[model samples]
Target chain A: MLGDALSLSLGYNATLVTLGATLLGAAAGMAGTFLYLRKNALISDAISHATLPGLGIAFLIAVAFGWDGRQLAILLGGSALSAALGLYFVNWLTRETRLTQDTAIGCILSVSFAFGVVLFTIIQVLPAGRKAGLESFLLGSTAGMLYSDALLILVLSIITALVLVVFLRPIKLVTFDASYSETLGISVRRVDFIILTLTLAVTVLGMKIVGLILIVALLIIPAVSARFWSEKTDIILITSTAFGALSGYIGSAISAVSAGLPTGPIIVLCAFGFFLISFLFAPKRGVLAVALKHYQFQKTVHLTQGLLSLALRQSIYEPKTRRLLQRFGYIRADGVVTEVGKSLAAKTLLNEKRWSYWQETLRESDQFDGQVVFSLMDIETKLTQDQILLIDQGLAARKGKKL
Target chain B: MMSGIALVSDKGVLLNAAADDRNAPFTIRGLTVSYGQVPAVYSIDFTAPAGSLIGILGPNGAGKSTLLKAAMGIVPVVSGQVSFFGKPLKEARYQVAYVPQRASVDWDFPATVYDVVLMGLYPILGLLRRVSKADKAKVAESLAKVGMQDFADRQIGQLSGGQQQRVFLARALTQRADVFLLDEPFSGVDAATETAIISVLKILQLEGKTVIAVHHDLSTVSTYFDHLFLLNRKAVAYGSVTKVFTKDNLVTAYGGKLGAAQLDAIGL
Candidate 1:
């Protein structure tokens, strides 16, 4: 795999494939960043859908001249033209009509996708169309490359990506807050226009490998995943680029092994896999991390509440007994409960304090409540002298007429 | 007050007196703006001698913010011009600074306070320009001036509303510009943060840098304002507070259609 990639990146086939994939990846990533940020993720979806008409139109034009539409000029020109028209329609639907942005995008996205499918079918139906080069155009076979097609895709993606990198700050600012960017002497509308144009440009270029069906995912997932790993825009951009490159290479390789598999969907799926891992496992923003953190916080609170209740149950539970509550949550080291061993003991019943802690935990947890409130669940669960006091106080607080 | 820039009143009651000094500043003229077809501002014109502090006063939706945006070339003006030290906005862009309303943005943006302030240098730095030692020094100084030096690298979204406003002020300070346009700089800010921002604005004013602010609160109008533009879709009044901020002028600005029948026109 390694030698194959190097031979590809350095050799004509490899270099062309890698260069095309990487360039397309970067454009997708860059354009996707703005689209994601501006709450216009669906706009890319709309553009992708809308590109079909252009593909159909380009193919129709190609057939009239007895040429294959998969030629870079026809395929990309068709996609770009359709996408551009989709954007214009999007703007028009939003500005001229009473339709909102998403609604307009939806209307255009479905219509264009339908039109593209119709065009693909029409091209296939031609008497000599069996060899019309439709498979490469539809599924994106990066391995079977004619040099010029890859070169055009590379040039277009590079120019678009460079523009994104150059206008990074203003675009990021406008995406985050247009009104704020404007007052800072930056042109909000200009930045907005730049982002929209770049989105269209990158989408058109990426349609070769990333393809219409899965382009938005390739563009969005990498950045979304990278966001969990970094906060600074520079770091986010760098991380996103790295992820984009990795997914692009992996998707291409997968397609090389699987006969007739579409490279664009696979690439998108690869990027999405990375996102799923990041979403579920990342330390900072992952779902499991939040759940575990919440669990630990509750454990600490339960221990503290149990001890305070134990103290309140008796005018003063004996110092040794007073210390019992702490021991249930921790080891009684140096006359104070050490901040250790709480997790294991919460699962046990060593003493009254420990028992009380267990009962409170059960009552607070969904296991005991059947989805009821912790306070109400406390009424159903039995506990020690200390546990009752804690639950009563907690319930009192919940009622808002506090003790 | 982002829009309520500091200045001395007629009685020499120094408003936001901690400014650096009055210096070179931009001149906004004939600025007109409209959102689609509905007019937000029109024939808006004004100037501030290099170091003077001016406040833009108006009731809600009076186009005070629009005036500042037009001056910055952010808003598409139907017709008008803005000059900084007699130069167009693009030519002298780096010489001006803008602080937008704190409420106008979603502070949950994924950026640190340091990065927010660093954006002020973007014009001079350009895209892909690294922050040098000098740039770092400027960011540090701006943060310190707003009493947020320690929080420089902290995430902007984590800060309180007041702290976010301070971070924005620190960003404006980083510009080190001759003119500052702030919109509602003091809204949602605690007293200390308000005073701290005012002190910085005062220092800028004293240093001969002109500051124009869009202010909402009338109570602080006379206190911090040196020059005033009392607006209601058009220039109702412009000049010293005593000359323009009077009952009759305010009545002319907002008290229109007071009749019971006219109340219906204004939605009561």
Candidate 2:
């Protein structure tokens, strides 16, 4: 199975596709770090969704111009234009009105997606008929990605990565604090536009592999997962890139072997698997690590409570457990407690009492009082002779009180 | 306090060198800023000379913070202009540093103290330039100034409130500018941090770097700042702290919420 998987990974038919996807994923991850920090993850979603209408329009224009509607360059150009327009609208709405970034993004995402759907339906009924697999752009079908298309993705991804690095300091400053950056003389709007344009390019290019709907997952998940592993920005960026590359490579390889699974979904699933692993297993920040810490804390508290009660009952501590309990300052090595410990023990004993049935522990009217009696057998095994005698007397006194 | 004196004050107190000094670190003229329908700061005018520790003080809604932001062009001014060193803000951008309110930033942002401090070098380095060895030294020196050199590699969010403020102060320090505008550097910080910040501000003043800070605590106002600007959607008073920090001005700024004795107790 390993050999077969390795063979599939290195296969001629899959190599370019995998490489392109991997690069795209890495770019998205790098760019997504800023977007994520800015709390504008949905902007990518809106832009990606908005590209669909452009694709439809581009295809229509191509057909009108008597050219091939499936031409990659024309379609992508249209996609970029419309996506940019969608982003502009979002920015305008947020600026010119009371609508927040989230509201603006939602409006653009839904409206643009609806327009694309309508256009898709309209195109299907035209003379071109079904638009020659243009529907694959919706969920992304990588099976037909030509070598040229793969090359385009690779070059775009590399350029995006290089640009991001070049402007890393300014972009980092702006993303973390746009207002502050502005005060420091960085044009927040220009930096913001740079980021938006880069995102637009990456999202449009990535649509060939992950589809409009799932490309955001590739951007967001890897960065988010990387967050679980590191707190430093450079570390996060590098880790996110690695995660994205791994997801793209592994996801593509899996989809290749299965033959039935869609590349986009498989890629997202692989990213999600990494996310789950990070969520559950990453040290310090992961769920398992946090839960383990919490569990140990609770166990310690539980044991301390038990030891306190047992000490109240005059049971001698086992040397090993006593040493542990002593480490917590709950008991002395010589086995005698001060007033503070006595008060704590008294409080613990009182906490176990039933306030609603106080009279039941007193003298009862009959031998069978219907009141439940707790067994001290567990406490007896751990108690010394003098302590056992005191317990026996205490039990007898309670039994003798029954009428 | 002076290299030379050119003074102007409505309150007749010499706060610092006057607008005639030509190198006044900040000059705001008839500046008004509004949020939608409501005005936050209205018709504010002041010229802070180089080497003055000025405090912007007001009640919660009095727009003390807004005045600083508006001056820095972080908040849009409805009217008027702010100049740095007798030049427009854009022209003298290299000489201005702004430390935003501690709460205004996302603390969990993926950056270390060193990363954030290095951001101060960006304005000088420009978009395509890289950090030089001197720039790195400046960052280290700034961190050392704030006593945070040991925590340069620690993530910003892991810092305590005071340490975070120190980190921001370090960022501003790295600017090596002639003017620094700090928004509530003392808020949520311990007394020690407050003292550290004030001492840093004093050092900046001695070095001829003008510092304007939005200060919330009125009690420490007299001690921390030599010059004071009290605001209540408008400029209530601006001059030397002893002259401007009067009970009547406090009443106007705080809308009679503070009693005269309370103001007196705060050493108004």
Candidate 3:
């Protein structure tokens, strides 16, 4: 059943809803990259929450005109207007007052959302709003979505994604360095407006599938998850968009196969799954990779110290060091140093001595400042044979002087 | 003492001439910048000669950096006129390059050294234009100029503080402007980076470009800059290092921050 639903054999409305949700996810992911990079992720929450009042007002207007109040286009337009207003309010509060951006966002988010809840309650009490299905805007219900509604969402998502792609360079430049961008003649204000517009578009379009509350998850989670996987902006962008689309696709399909699951929370859960995976297992920056790197470094330190002890004819007291030395065949199970152990230990000691001597000699020169630290790396890799021989000769001369 | 007086009179004559040169590299008149109600830079007037290395020096909170930012039009000036090559800043912005302090931007931004340097060409590229071979060559040349060719593909944050500063300098060099404004370019940098940056600045000066830097090290003022503008919320002194870098001038600009012993240490 799940396979059929995923393959789009789940009938017409289900397929349209699934495709629309996927496009919305992709668009949100792309636009959210700039928002994330700008460190304004919380603003999207304010914008999305602020959309509820618009949704309620649009329904009222449609009902007053005796038209179907659940019209997706009219409701989306209303949400976009309110979201833009909320964004303006946040900016004004931040610029005109002493309130920080996050404080402004919190202010707008709570007040506007509370007003929206009141509107929702008012609409629920009206006879015309009895079957309005406005509750879907809270957690999103795609079960009874119209064909035209799905198409509208898909089309808007495509447009938003395309716009984001076209303006990605300027947006990235401004976000990374606003002062530099100004000197480059790129208007920081205009780029910021474009980002906010794209963010507004994504939020309004995402409301029908992901709901107002969970849309921020669609906007932030994918971008953040993608960050763990790459150090390149474009790669992170692509990864984020892919993650969003996959979450939307699987979440919508699951909702289609199961009657009771809400699409928004399911999609958000799916995005969270990606974040969890990236957090634990992505290479270089991931938790697991960092832990593994730390473990390898620790093992190297133990093995080197154990070998050095062997070279000095000392006993290994630490159990972990002894086990590591034995595993590497540097020591016998009886805590005795093997032939291999002595030679390796001697080389380690020599490398340590060579590094110290090199540091002392170059104390006045910063030529090898950050790289000359004593590590398990071979000295031959860091210095030429002639340099090593010179150091060795110097060491011999020092010993001769001591004698 | 007589020769010192003669040098001051000579510099005074030069300053007067430069004020009306019209073709001066940079000229600021009655410049005042404020943050909210508090003034940071107040009523400062200065002009730079062609092909000269100038230093803007002051103690902490003395508005040395504020002066640069206001001159570059990055920060709004309360009242002033900043002209570049006899034209307004907007008209001649392309001829001016600015290197903001390294701490002003996030180094962890996702970009390679090459990518950041390539941004120098963004104004010329405009929208819908691809970076051509010549532009790429220019970026490569700038990186090579700063001895950062090996770090072209490395992430920006992976570099040391000095390397990061070098990368910013390379970005500014790619602008190929007639005047360079640097804010604390040598601060927190290693000796090698300082040497590399000073050499590059000297080369720029030799090529007839005006290099104006906000400098902190009073000891290197005479060695690095041919001209100095001493500012402490106002223009304290402005002239050649030998003429203006005096005990009285240091005390005036620093305002009790520089003691007699400290002034003696810098040979003021």
Candidate 4:
């Protein structure tokens, strides 16, 4: 069953929903990159939550006009209006009052959502609202999605992606440095507005698929995960979009094969799975990479210290160090140093002596390059052959004078 | 407690000439800016001639940065008129370049050193324009000027504080504007970076471009600036470094915060 769903053989309706969810995920990921870079990821939460009130009001108005209250277009339009209003309120409160952005977002998010819940309960008690299935929007259920709803999601996602592509450069510049963007004749306020609008579009489109509650995850997690992969803005953006689309596609397919599973939680879980993978295994910035780097550094330090001990004729007490030296054939089980061990030990000792001599004597004279860091890395990598020879001569002269 | 000789206000005489000269790089009249109800900078009048390096000096919270921000229209001015080359700032924006303080932006943003410098061409390229090979060459040239050519591919956050400052200088250089406004360019930079920056400013001045920087170190003032605008919310003195950087001006700007020995050290 799962294979059939994954292959998009689960009938026409299922395929449409899966494809729509994929596009929605991709759009969210792309738009969310700018929001994440701007350091305003939580603003999407306020915008999504605020859409609840608009959804409820739009339902009531539709029922009063004797039309289908769950018409996807009408409901999404209402939610978009409310989400934009919520965004405006967040900005207004932040700018006009002493409240910070987070504080303002919290205020609007709770108040608007609570008002929405009040309307939701009122609708729930009514006779016509009993079969409304509005509860599906909370966690998202594509079980009975209409053809037009799927088409709407697909169109909006494509439009969002196109708009982002056209404005990507300016959006990136503004996100990186707003003051500099303004100096360059780009309107910072307009760019900010465009970002907020894109964020709103993604949130509203995500309501029928990921639901309002988990939509913020779809918008933020992919971008955050992508940051672990690359340092370039364009690469991060593309990687995040792909991650989001993958999550949406797989999550919807899995949900289609199961009888009672909702698509929203599964989609969020898929995105978190991607986040977990990137967090643990991505290169450079990932957990595994960092741990590997630390381990390598530790091994180098232990080897250097072990060599120093052998040079000084001291006993090697650390078992790991002893095993490392033995594995490299630098030492024997009977605590005897080999010819290679002796040569390495002597070189290490000489390097240490030259380093100290340079630090204690020639350091303040400014004769050597100050950029060379003598610790951790090999001294030879940092200094020229002539410079190392000069340091060695200085070390020998100091030893002769001490003698 | 102000003890300076009462000199004639430089406002009225320069105001008419500033409008007519057309060569004056920057001219400001009655510039006032406030944050909330408190004023950051009061009404002030100043002008910078072409081919001169000018320093805006003041104590902490004395509106030194606020003055430059106001002139660039980054902050809303309560009442002021700022002109570049005898034209309003908007009309001559392409001819002006601004380098904000390094600490003002998040260094952890995912951008390469080359990418940040390439942003200098955004105004010229505008929207929907591709960066040509010449533009890339210009970015390389600017990076080479600041000794950061080798760091083009390095992430911006990977650089040291001095290297970061140099990257911003390189970005400003890429703009190739006629007038440069820098906010605390030398602060938190290494000695080498400071020397490099001052030399670049000197070269720009020699090339007949106007350079105005918000400077903190008083000891380097005489050597770094050809003209000084001593400010503490308002202009205290505005003229050549030898004439404006006197004991009275320091006392008024700092409000006796400078010890007599400290003033003597900088030869005030």
lDDT of every predicted structure (CA atoms): 0.70, 0.80, 0.86, 0.86
B1-268, model 1: which lDDT tens digit per residue?
1222332223233232343222224555677799888889988766565567688877788898888877777667898777776678777766788888888776766788888888778777877778799999999998888888778878776777777888888888887877788988888776767777778888888886778888866667777877777888998877777676666676677766334454343233
The per-candidate count of clashes, in order, stands at 32, 1, 0, 0
Candidate with top TM-score is 3
Residue B56, model 3: lDDT of 94
The C-alpha stretches of model 2 lying farther than 4 A from their native spots are A1-11, A296-403, B1-22, B127-133
Query: How far is B151's C-alpha from truth in model 3 (Å)?
Result: 0.7
lDDT of 1: 0.70
| Per-residue C-alpha lDDT of model 2 across residues B143-244, encoded as one tens digit per residue | 988877788888787788888899999998888888899988899886667777899999998887788998888888888888898888988888888888
> Per-residue lDDT tens digits of candidate 4, residues A302-383?
8888998999999989999998888888998787999999999898887788787767865533223234345445778766
Kept native contacts, as fractions per model, are 0.53, 0.75, 0.41, 0.65
What is the RMSD of candidate 2? 12.5
* lDDT per residue as tens, model 1, A1-403: 5456634644566566666776677667767766766767778778777777787787778877978655777777778877888888898999878899988988888888777777778778877566666545554566566678677767766776788878888987787768666656678768877877777776776766766677777778888987777667777777777777778877766665556777788778888888988889988678898899887666655654444443333233345544545556454535443444444333232334443444555343212222222322233244566766665565546568643
Clashing pairs in 2: B6-B18
The digit string of per-residue lDDT tens for model 3 on B130-210 reads 889999999999998988877889898788888899999999999989889999999999888899999999999888788
| TM-score, first chain, each model | 0.73, 0.75, 0.91, 0.88
Shift in Å, residue B153, candidate 2: 2.1
Predicted candidate 3 versus true structure: per-residue lDDT over A46-144, tens digit per residue? 999999899999999999999999888899999999999999999999988989999999999999999999999999999988899898888877877
DockQ of each: 0.23, 0.30, 0.47, 0.45
**How much does candidate 4 score in TM-score?**
0.91
Which residue pairs collide, candidate 4?
none
Error of 3 at B186 (Å): 1.2
